[model samples]
Target: MNRDQMEGNWKQFTGKAKEQWGKLTDDDLDTVAGKREQLEGKIQERYGKTKDEAKQEVDNWFDRNGW
Candidate 1:
């Protein structure tokens, strides 16, 4: 899914995000809600990953699963 779709479907997607990264909090999900930039930023902040890395990870999951 693209960023807009992901944002629109965040309620469903957040569960997947949490399943992937158990360390992520509800606040993190809330912060990232409906914003691709915010999602990448929060993932980077929480996971200590580079921005590109975080985006790639999210993108990869989306592509791999055809979500």
Candidate 2:
């Protein structure tokens, strides 16, 4: 889903996000709160990935989840 839609459905996505990025703590997800940039930043922080790579991974996750 788009950012707004994702935010609106944040609770629903939390479990899936945690499943996908198991290294992320609940605090990290809470900080993200469904913001794409925040999620990307968290991914980068937790995975040591480049910014673009994190963004791509998020995009791919969204696509796979039919969001």
Best by the lDDT measure:
2
TM-scores of all predicted structures: 0.82, 0.96
Off by over 4 Å in 1: none
Error of 2 at 37 (Å): 0.3
lDDT string for model 2 (1-67, tens) is 6678999999899999999999999999899998999999999999999999999999999989998
Instruction: Pick the TM-score winner.
Output: 2
Q: Pairing residues by index, what is the TM-score of model 2?
A: 0.96
RMSD of 1: 1.5
TM-score, predicted candidate 1 vs. hidden true structure: 0.82
Cα lDDT over the full model 2: 0.93
